[model samples]
Target: MHMMLMADEKRLCKRFFHFRIAACARAHLLRRSVCAGFLTFLIAAVFCLSLFSAAPVKADDKVLRVLAWPGYADADVVNHFEARYKARVEVTLVDSDEALWAQMHAKGTPPFDVLAANTAEIQRYTEANLLAPLDLARLPNTRKQLPRFQALASIGGLTSGGKAYAIPFTYSSMGLIYDRKQVAVAPRTMRELWNPRYRGKVLDFNSAQHNFSFTALALGYPHPFQLDPTEMRTIAHKLVDLRRNLLTYYTLPEEATAFFIQHKVALMFGNYGTQQVELLRRAGADVGYVIPDEGALAWLDCWSMTRAAADPPLALAWINYMLEPDVSALLTQRQGLANTLTAPVESSDSARIVWIGPVENIQRREDLWARIVSGDRSERF
Candidate 1:
């Protein structure tokens, strides 16, 4: 098992290297080389199909429907699966866990075989009995995953029992993206965001999750996920207090990036996905990002197989395929997030600061965030 896991890791690292190379040599690949690579991939697909054609039929065989974020599983992934298994995929895009839960309840039975949601939301779904037991025997890739990831998947720290639930997918962290030319130094702690130095020049997330977590960290809270009533009150007051100093509360990273580029803001709370910081640096804005020492919040999005999956085997197959090193690297690289199947490649400086590791602390985040948004408490931080 260890050998297999290591092999997958090496494969992931190698593929990540190729992705970096490809990114740098995109122009060269574009003119004529890309066609040859595509042809080779197609030929490989044909060979895989022939090899698997004689495999015994499984009990669960049908369209492997999935609910995921937009642009998650791309064309190559889809084609690889369809050609090999001769199966169909029906995809539905969802933006939030609340929306996903609503769909499950409204449908009575889950309409999709596989569901993608953040690590925190999976807890809610599991409690609601909306998910099925994940058979680890079927997911060899899970073993090669990082220890922190395994801890996140475990329910209260038990491996096997907890393992029977969700498969770890991708992860990212909340960080500060700033215009370096406008700021003298990067803030090492969440409290710096409130410094009068950046007052009215700070962009923030309007979403309850990021907003609340930032305050919780600034207040020296032990864990964002373990917010008590007093902690919740403190967070609410802090946000209300910061309102006057904030330039704008943004819902999307793009909006925050736009503000920074336009010189409307100097620093903003941002996640790992943006090319904004990089672009700003190149444009002479002196920009960069940081994962504050206050212990930034990290999130993992996983693939949860619904209990009512109409095609269980096919769904499992898709999950396994996604665990493939190269495939996982492609998704993580493009999406700007980390996942179970791949490790962070240091070539991208953002990868070093991007959020990784266990999500056990997230449960505290959810509750504290809820309190702040609901206006349930109003004490000063």
Candidate 2:
């Protein structure tokens, strides 16, 4: 009987290892809430065990292809997924959302089977029919996710025509990162980035979409994503002011971190927020992060399968494995990003986080932003 219990536990561990100990899953575990799935897992495990008590045979030569932002698919996470499922995992990192879109549509079959993108970007992918309808049956661990994330259809870009497309992954607010040693007081508003006191010491992300939207947010525009042409002119002038204040605009999180340390940056528009915080702290910098009174812009990134998925079941396995407590916890511990499956002790929830959405006039914003950065005066807009 003891041997049977031990064997059953091992089997159960394999089926639900990701959720058995995570904060998001622990709460549900204590409530005896996973009984239904647990039963299903037990039956499934028994069937698999009947095949072999040793490692399962690799079914095919297909590799599970993945495209994601940095820190999402750490080495250990991929290795574990590969080992458990007897499949190879290939990962590609995308720097920006625009880059991700270009890659996704770069021909017939994408180089990825699964990809991570925010709600706003996924809306574009879904609209373009570049994604495959998610088969929830294959990813039983979806039950282990946070209740808020479970309703994928409710999110703008995740579902259409009664089919789910993505699984909520990591999220973070692009808040303010101020140098505590240099600045005596923490900044309290987005408008403070324009303060002349930090001239030539402030860093902003070199992204047209972010700057235009951030400026609108700073000006108290009702919807930062949807702006009128007149609003564009007003925000353009604000960008010119911000441009004069900035030491240099950054492209990637790593670039922002390196600039912060090398240039003695006093303040930064932390596009990656805590992820950037982690990178800076690792480099031995004293920085303070905050979502100012005006609120911060946030992105809800999720995992979705591409229509060109090399192996659909294998792709779903990666998603389910990622939802595991250990994998999700690693996101907070390593990257400092919030996991959808677990709440970090550092308070992932903000009173005001303006999640990103599709913006109006993509070309116009890019054009005007270029002009502003190229020393275009306010009148140019």
Candidate 3:
């Protein structure tokens, strides 16, 4: 009976050991399943977080659309302005006054918030009610400008109906550029353009308004911009005479430079003034620039706000920024343009700078100029 009882106890111990082992296996399987589910959940969470991070953020809404000349709004300059104002700048570059006019009048409200134009164009814009009156109070940098620019009333086309519409930014005198090797002495007057000795070696700007004005100056007309019908006909004949002396009429500074180098041009009307001089010098042309004794036609480019500015304050800020010393100096350094903040070294005190004004009749001049360019005879005038 004792042996049987001991065997029973051993069997009971073996059964308990088996049961414990099964329970341990079940627990281990449950732990692995829980770990696998947890791992899947963590990966999904990481992927979701990455997707959220990869989403694009909205861009800045403050955009300043600018219409300017080639060197006026350079990439670096525009970038600096954008960073300072925390806004994006869209720059549109126009090469000619006609192109600028087309861009300004293309849309009903003038797509640009602000633009750079010469004083004559400023007057045209004012007459058309395309510009807004500038608030002097907003542009504190005007105090830093030279005395000439400070006297806004003295500058033609800046003010209309007692309201100031523009601020002077840069200026250049239309003078004469001659090759040092070809010409011994600098040309003293605009009459040198028609010198018979330099025929087929002279280059002129292909513009109606400027050609008429300078021809009037050459003829000793008191007011070049206010020519009468008789004066216009006389000047047109004079230009026809000039056309005989021309190698070709150039519209851009670079084109003129190429012509000077390639064609061995002896004389040229420096339409871009010192800016062209800089370009020619950089191109290794030994050229001399001189303002004629009669007086050189000058264009004072200014900044003006459009009548349909989306943000007036922002537009005013751009104008004010342009007047800053650094910005103004950059214009001179890069473009060779004379800024209003400082006096130009290239200009002489004795040089007469005739600022451009509204012309007598633009359409008439354009019509005559087109005919002249097409080889019209002097008798047609």
Candidate 4:
């Protein structure tokens, strides 16, 4: 009996070792396959494990394809995610929503599974039926996100069917970035920039929508995104009043940063928490970013999955992984941008307002911006 028991014990040990070895191999293979289809891979792995008692898995099978803003995803992010999950990620950058939409539409295959776009483009993509609804159950990190961000990710229109079409990534309020060395006392209101003392010494965003919204704010009308016809007209009048004082209106942050470095502009309106602030500071520019009492127009960017995605599961995995506090924190910390992750590593009231909050009635101003840019509203200026 003793000999028989000894033989049984040996058999059990061998079986256990075999199981472990197989699991390790499977883990590696699954990582490669699902890295791009993050959550989808997890589900498929479970199914595979149940079927194959001892299957070899390769790590390279899991490369997630991602499309985001320049500087949003870097080698560091890819390394971290890949190391943790044993997967790889390929990232691409885009400049504007129009460009992103056009590319995806033209390709039809949505070369990437994930895309990053602003709120306006997010709406446009969803309307064009080029986006897919996000699977919230697969994303545990979504629970950590704030309420306002949650709303932004969901489509409210009946045509949109109230589905969650995107994930809120980051946002910034339109505020002035000033050189502390030049302006010992910062201007308290948008109206202050109108003073002749700062004429031809200010930089602003070239965006018609953003400027229109800011104009509404300056006119003491409701927020630009929520403007009525009367408010729109009033804001239009305010914009014309400042045309001469404006040195130049710029779209990219780099343009403004250059001007600030050269002392070409004493004050410039910039997006809060963008890479520009960090870059300017690194260059030894005494820059101060602020959102005055008038409250500034807010803009947000989001992560959207393409409807033509080849591996929806892999895309879900990357989305869920990015929502993790550690991941979100790393992204925001490096980029100097705010994320949806609760209890981030640091905060300022300015960053807090821009990174968090509802759309805050900004869509109302879209038409206003179109009119202004087309010269239809030029008379008001």
- Best by the lDDT measure: 3
CA lDDT, every prediction?
0.64, 0.81, 0.86, 0.64
lDDT of 4: 0.64
The parts of candidate 4 lying over 4 Å away from their true place are 1-65, 79-90, 106-111, 144-162, 226-237, 272-274, 344-381
TM of each candidate vs. truth: 0.67, 0.81, 0.82, 0.67
Against the correct fold, how does model 1 do in TM-score? Answer: 0.67
Q: For each candidate in turn, give its C-alpha RMSD to the true structure in angstroms.
A: 16.0, 19.6, 31.5, 23.9
RMSD of 4: 23.9
- Cα lDDT tens digits, model 1, 1-381, are 999999889766644543443253334335445667889899999988987886765556457888887556787788888889888677777544545666766745547788877666676677667788777678777777777666654433112343556777776666677766777777787777777777567767655555665676767765665566677666767875564456555443444555566645777777434334544555556666777776666566787788888877778888777778887777555655666755676333443232332234444656655554333324422
lDDT tens digits, residue span 265-308, model 2:
89999889899999999999999998977778999999999888
- Off-target runs (Cα >4 Å) in candidate 3 are 1-60, 107-110
lDDT tens readout by residue for model 3, 267-361: 99888888888898999999998888899899989999999888899999999999999999988898788999998886654448898888999
Q: Order candidates by lDDT, high to low.
A: 3, 2, 4, 1
Off by over 4 Å in 1: 1-61, 106-110, 143-163, 272-286, 347-381
Which pairs, if any, clash in model 3?
none
